[model samples]
Target chain A: MNEREPGIDRRQLLKGSLALGMASLLTPRVLRANDSSTVTLPFERGRRPLVAFPQKRPLMVMTTRPPQLETPFHIFNEDIFTPNDAFFVRWHLANIPREIDINTFRLTIRGRVKQSLTLGLHELQTQFEQVEIAAVCQCAGNSRGFFQPRVPGGQWGNGAMGNANWKGVRLRDLLQRAGIERDAVQVRFDGLDQPVAQATPDFRKSMSLPDALQAEMLVAHSMNGEALPLLNGFPLRLVVPGWYATYWVKMLNDIEVLNQADQNFWTSQAYRLPANPCHCVDPGDALTDTVPIGKMPVRSFITSLENGGTIPGGERCTIKGIAFDQGHGIDRVLFSVDGGQQWQSARLGKDFGDFSFRPWEAQFIPKPGHTYALQSLAINRIGESQRFGARWNPSGYLRNVVESVKIHAS
Target chain B: MIPVWMFLLLLVGATGFAWGSPANGNDREQGSILNLPADPISFQPGPGNDLASRYCLMCHSAEYVYTQPPHPREHWIEIVNKMNASFGCPISDEDMTPLVDYLVTQNSLQPSPSAQHVQRDDLKETPGQSSTQSGDPQKGKTLYGRHCVTCHGPDGKGDGPIGQALVPPAANLTLLGKQSDQTILDTLRNGRPGTAMPAWKNDLNALELNHLLSFLRTLSP
Candidate 1:
C-alpha cells in the first residue's frame, strides 16, 4: 500500500525482489532532539518488505534467529481477538520442535501430585471437559524501547503483544485430575524451546500454587478454534489470563509442582521488576529486592493517528484504540485533546472477557493551526489508571504509561 | 528416491530444520526450519575487534554491539561486566579492558582525528541550515543500492534479507531525521569502529558521502 505513496522511489520494488537470506549492511539512525520530548516516545513501526514465515503472515520482523515478529497496530484497530496468524511471535531459545505426532506426544503432570498422569493428545481432548477463554498475552517488555534512561534489551515497538481465544482444559481441572498435594507451593512449566549451549539457562517459569488453581488458567491445545500455528507453540501452551506472556509457556510439555519458590534463572534472575506499587526503580538505582513480573497494568494507545501525521482542519475524525488491564477489566478509556487538561469518555465496545482487549472510540473535530496531543488513558475496574510518565525499570518490564500521539492540523 | 514421509524425516535430520509442525490434513502451515536471512554485521579486523569476534560471536553476532544507541565508555564497561557476571560470558579478566576500549572507540560518536575537522564544520551547520547543500538524492540512491541495500534493507528498516540473522538486528535508518546530520556523517566516515559498519573514507569521496546523506534524509518522516 505504501509503495504508491509520493516520494517513495523504485527502492521499494527492489526490496521485494531481493532474497531476505542474503547478507547486507544497514546504517543506524539516531533520534532527533526536536522530535522527542524529555519523555522518550515509542519507536514507530518500521515498514518491512512482506515475507511470510511458517504458519504466519508477513509480519513486522524484529529478529530472525529464534523468530521475533511484531503484529502491526492496524490489526489491533480491527478486532479485539487478534487473528491466530496475526498473533505476535516471541521465542527465547534457539531449539524449538519442528513437528510432534499427536499419538506420540505426551503431557506429563508429575511433581507433588498424588497420582502422576501422562496423557496423549486424544485422551487430553476426550478425558477432560474442554473450555475456552479470550485473553491478552503480552510480553513483559512490550514497550521496552520507550523506557527512559533506555535499558538494554529487545528494542520493541508497541506491537510485542496480542489477544486470542484459547481452547483447552483448565489448569484447575488438570491439577484436580493429578490430585495436587496439600504442601504444593508453586507450579512450574517447561516447553520444547531449548537453548543451544548447555551452559545457557533453560527457559522456564513458575507461579504460586494459588495462581495456578485459578479457573481462568488453561492448558490450551487450540487457539481461535483451530490447532495452534507451529510458530505459536502448536500442540499445547499454557494460558495465564490477565498476566504477561512469560507465564504463558508455549510448546508446553511438562508441569512440575514445586514445594518451594522457583530458584531457576528465568524466575530468579530474569523477568523481574521492582516490588514497589509503581513497579519502577530510579535510573541506575541498584535494585534491593525484586519480584517476578506478573499481571500487566492498565495501558492504551491511539491507533488511528500516526505520530506527526497531518489532518485537515474542521474535519470531524473518530479516534479509536484498544485498552486492557490485568483482568480487573477496563472501566473507561478517556481521550485527551488539550493535552492532559481535559478528557472525554470514549465509547466502549463489546466485552469479550476480563482478560480480553476492549476496544474504545471517541470523535473530535480538529482545530486549525493547532497541534493536538492525542492521548488515551485506560482505567481499570479497581480505579487504577495509567501514569503520564513511564516508570523506569532495569529489564524494561510492565511499561503502562499513557500513550500519546502527535498530529498536525493543516 | 525416498518416500514422502522418509524424505521429510531425512530433511529434518539433515538440516537442523525442526521448527514448524508437519503439514497434516489441510494444514497449510507445515514446514521445517525458518531460513531467516543471516546477519550482515562483521567486526572490522583490529586487535580489540578480533577479541570481540572470538569471544562475543560465540553467543551473539556483532549486531548486538552495533544496534546500541551510542553510549559512554562507562556504559560499555557496565555492559561487558554484566555479560560476564550475569549471563556467564567467558572472557578472561585481562581481556575485559581491551574489549571495552574497542567498543567505546567504535561506538562512541566522538570524532577521530581524521574526521575531527569535518565534525566541527558539521556541528556549526544548525538544524535549519543544509550542510549537504551539494548532495544529490539520485546519485545517493545509486550508491545506496550498491553498498547499503543489503543490510539496511530498501527502506532503511534494517530488515535487509541478510540482516535478519543478526543478534541485535540491524539499525533502522528511517529514524535518523531526529539526529543531527553531523552524527550521521561521522558514522558514515568512521563506520562505527568496532561494529560491522565499515569506515567509508576509503570507499567514497566527500561529495559522494554528502549525497548518501541526502538520500538517507528522504527515508525519515
Candidate 2:
C-alpha cells in the first residue's frame, strides 16, 4: 500500500523494500535535514503474535491491528526442520538495526568482573567456543492471551513461539574472560536498539550472575545456521533456553557484571514473579518484592489439535505438542481427555540437545463423532506442576499454566 | 497456526480490586503454572488490563508499556508524568481536572503508558531561539527536514516514523504550507492540540521555525 504513494523517489522505495526484505542495497541516499519524509514507524504487533507472516511469495499480508493466524496450524515441510525464509520474524521495536557492520560494533563487559571490556561482533563470533543449540525462544507473554480476565497485551492466541538452531559463543567463556570479580551478584544486559521514548532511550535489561554465566547461556549470532535476521538481533542476542523470551535481549551491546545488582527498573522493580498463589486478591495486598523473572516456570502446551480444533470422528489421530521446563528439565508430560479427569502419560521424544526445545508428541484414536476437550500438561523434575488456569499478577508474569485444546468431531 | 479456542481474558488484576472469583494468594490458579504456585493475585482497576499497562498505556501504546512489566508505580507515574510534563501532554491547571478525571476514572491508578518518562535536568530550562526566519523555504526545508521527516514524508505527506501507527495518521506537512502562516506557526509553537505532535516552541528556534514553515508551504499535497 505504501510503495504507491506519490513522489516517494526510487530511493525511498529502495529503503522501504529493503526493510520488507525485498530489495538489496544498491546506493545510499543522502538524508536531508529539511526534507519532509516518512520513515518506517515501529508497527507494534500487539494485536497478533506475528504481524507479518508470509502466506505466499511477493504477497506480504499485514494483520489487522495485530496480525493473527486465522487458520489452524497444520504441520507441513516438517522434514528439514523449519525452512530458512519461512522462519518467523519477531521484533520489539520499529527501529530494528538494518545492517550490522561487524567493524565497529562492540560488546561492553563490566560490573562484577575483574576488568570491563568491549568486544566487537567479529570478536564475539571468533573468540569463544562456537556452539549451536536448537532452542525455542518464546516471549513470556507468548500465550498471555490464554490468561483469564482478558488481560490485554498482545492478544497472541499462540504463534509467539518458534524453534531455531542458534549459533553463538558460550556466555560463560566470555564471563570468565572478563573474570567475575568477587562479590559479583548479578549480570545486566542492554541492547543497541534505543527505544526513543518521551524519555531518553533506555532500551536495556539485566540478569543474575548465575543466569548470565550459566553453562547454557549463549551470545548467539546465527539462527537455523544463518546470519541472524536483522529483526532478530542480526549481530547477536542472548539465548536463555527453557526460560521466557524476555531475557533474550537482541542487538546485544552491553554486559555488566554487578557486584551489587543494578538498580534498573527492568531488574529491581519489574519483571517479577507473583507474591501470591491465586488470581483473587488486592494487588496492593501483595508485597511488591522486586525480583528476577528467573527460570521459566514448568509448563506445557498443546501444539497440535488446537483449541476449537476439528477432526474426522472415529479417525485415529495423534495429539502432540512441545514442552520442557527451563533449567530443571522436563521428566514427564501428561495428557488429559476429560478436562483433567483420568490423565494419561504422553510418549516422550528424544532430547534435541542442550537448552533447546524438545518437541513432544502423543497419539490417540478419537471416539467417532465426539467433540472432546484435550489438554496437555508437563511437570518438571523440580516438582513444578502445570495447573489448568492462570493467576493474576500486577505485571502478568510467568504464565506456566497448563493450556487446554478443544477438538471438534465432524 | 492461531489457536481457534477462545482463551479466558478476564484475568485477576493487581490494582487491589474486589471482583471475580476472589483473588488467590499462596494458591495456584486451576490449570495454571505448576505446583510452583500461581503468581501473586493482582487487581488492576481495568479488569481487561493489568496494572503495568493500565497506567502506562493511557498516553502511549500498550506494546511499549507491557513489553517489560513488574515495575513500581512510582516509576510508572514518573513515566506518565514525564510524557505529560516533558514530551507534551498539553494540560494546564485548567485542564488538569479533566486530565485527572480521565485518568482517575481509569481502572488503573499506575502511570499511563506513553513516550518515555525521561527525567531530564534541562526540562525546566527555557528553549533557545533559532537563527532562520519562520517562512524561509531554504530555512524551513532544512528545519522541517530534521524534525519532520521521521513522521511526515519528504514531500510533506504523512509517512514519518510515528505516522504509520497513528489513528488518523499524521498531517500532510506539504498541505499545511498552503494554510495561513498564523495557523502553521500556532501549530508549530503549541502543536496540534490532539495529535502526537509536540510543542516545537521548545525544540526549535525562530530561524529554524521560519525555514520549516517555508518548506512546509511549498508542498501542495
Candidate 3:
C-alpha cells in the first residue's frame, strides 16, 4: 500500500522527516582503543591501518569520516559470496545516517509520474514479487593505487570489489506502480547521505529509462542473505548489476522519474571516463572529451596466492581465483605462468548468474629457488577479453589489465 | 504472491544455508544503528596546518591526504582548487596559498626521506634542543584549535565530547606546565600507549610541537 499526505511537498517532507528521525536516534557508541594494525599495499604510500567499523571486520581503512573501507583481498578466497560483515563500504558524502528507523523509513517515488507513492519496508516485501540475483559491486577506481604515475584519488588496491547475492524487488515494478509518464527520459536515485555543507551538491545518480526497467536492476534490501550493515547501506540500496559501484547508490530512499536528462554534479562532472572506446588517454595528455562511466570491463584476479609469497617447492599447487564481466558470463579463463607468454584454461567453479563472480581454479608446479610470474586472463561470452597491457586514464577507471603476482617457490 | 514451488525452493534454500544460496527470509525487519569509530589520524602540522584542518577535515579524515601517493605542488594546487571550485569547499583565496604550501611540504614527490617512516628510537635519541627554539603561543593556539579542541577541551581540561568516549581519556594539559620540555616533547612526538593519544610526530614537526607546548603552558591554573 502506498500513502500520500495531502498538501505536503514530498521533498520537504523527506528532509523534515529525516532531520527528525536523526534527532531521535541514540548517540553512536565509540569503539575502544584504535586498532593501530596496518596492511601495506604493494605500492608507495600504500600502508593503511586496519580499523573495525560497526558490523565489520578490521578492513583496510581508506578514510575514516565518510568511512571508505576496502575488503582485504584474501576475503575473496574464503567464499564465492562476500560476507556481509566484510563487504567494502564507500560513501560520497560525509554526513551518512548513523541510524535508520524502519518504521518511519520510506522509499519515495515522485517526479513525472501519475502519482507520487511512498512505500514502507513491509509493503515493499509483501506487495511486490521478490527476486534474488548474485552480482559483483566494484568501485570504478578499484585498482587506482596500481596505476603508474599514480592518480589523485582513493588509492585502493584490488580490494574495492565484492560479490554478493542481492535480494529485493525489481525497480521496474515500483516505477510501473507510480506509472512513469511518457516524457520520462531518466530515473534519478538519491540516498540518506548528505554533504556536510549546504554549498556541496547532494550525491545523486541517474540511469536511462530503458536501463531502469531491466529485470536485474533491484532495490536490494538484503545482501548475502542477511540485512546489510549500516555502513553498507542498510534498509535499502540500489543494485545496478554489471555497472560500476558509482551507479549503485547506497542508503537509497528516493527515486525520481525525470522528464529531462539529469546534469547533476555526480553524473556530469565526476566518475567520468574518456569518451573513446578504450576509455583511455596517454599519461600527461589532457582529456578532450568524456562520458559517464558505465558497464564494468572484464577483470580477473588470482586470489589464493599473494604477490611476493612463497609456494610449495617443486610440487603442484592449486591456484584459485575469480573472474567477472559486465553480465556477459565468463566463457573461458586463461592462466599464464611465465608472464603471458603461454596460457592454459582454468576450470570454472560454478555458475551463479551472468553477473556473479565466476570462480576459476588452475594448477601450477614450481621449481625450488625460482620465481614465477603468474597471471590470469578472462574472456566473456561476447569475445571481450582482458588486454596484456594496461590502459591509462586520468581518473584511473576500468582497470582490467591482466593482473600478475610474483611468487617464489620456497 | 510467491508460488508453492518457489516457496518450497526458498525453504530448501534456508535449510541448506550455504554461501551462495538464494534468499531465506532471514533479512532483518528492524532499522539498524551504527557507532562509528573516532578519527585516529591528523594532518601534518606546518604553516597552513590550521587552514588544511578547517577545510579538509570538514568532509573526510586526514588519512585521505596521507594515503595518497606523493604528487607535485602543481597537482596539490589543482586538487585544492578543485575542492574549492567543484566540491564546494569554501576555502578563501588568501588562505589557499598557505594551505597549498603545507600540502606541498608534507606530500611532495621529491626524493627526500619520508618524515612518516622515521623510527621512534631515532627521534628519541636525537638532540632535543634543536627543536626547542623560542616558540610562538599565538600560532600554537591556532594549531590547537585545528587539531586538539575536538578531543582536549578548549580550556585544556580533557572534557571535550570525543575525549569523554575514550577509555583512557585525553590529557589535562593545564597540569603539565611544570614538566620538562623534553618529557613533554617525547609525549607529543611519541603518543602514550594504551590510550587515545595518537603520536603527533608524523603530523606535527618539532617546531610545531614546541609551539603547542608553549601554548599548553599558558593554560596552567
Which candidate's lDDT is highest?
A: 3
TM-score of each model's chain B: 0.43, 0.41, 0.48
lDDT of 3 by residue, A177-243 (tens): 9999999999999999887645678999998999999999999998887877777887899999999
Best first by TM-score, ranked: 3, 1, 2
TM-score of 1: 0.71
Worst 10 residues of 2 chain A by lDDT: A56-65
Question: Which residue pairs collide in model 3, if any?
Answer: B45-B203
Interface RMSD of the candidates, in order = 12.2, 21.7, 13.8
Docking class of 1: incorrect
Predicted complexes: DockQ each: 0.06, 0.04, 0.18
Question: Judged by DockQ cut-offs, is candidate 3 incorrect, acceptable, medium or high?
Answer: incorrect
Runs in model 3 deviating more than 4 A are A1-36, B1-32, B108-221
lDDT of model 3, residue A2: 18
lDDT of 2 by residue, A1-410 (tens): 12122443333333443343222111111121122311111222222122122110110111211111221133311422343334443443333343456677888888767888789876776778898887766666655544444443444434455667888999889889989888987887888654323333354677767777667788997777666544456568888887777788888988887777677755665456654444333444454544556666666667665567688877678777777667566778998877788788998776776354556777777786787878888877777777666765645556667666787777
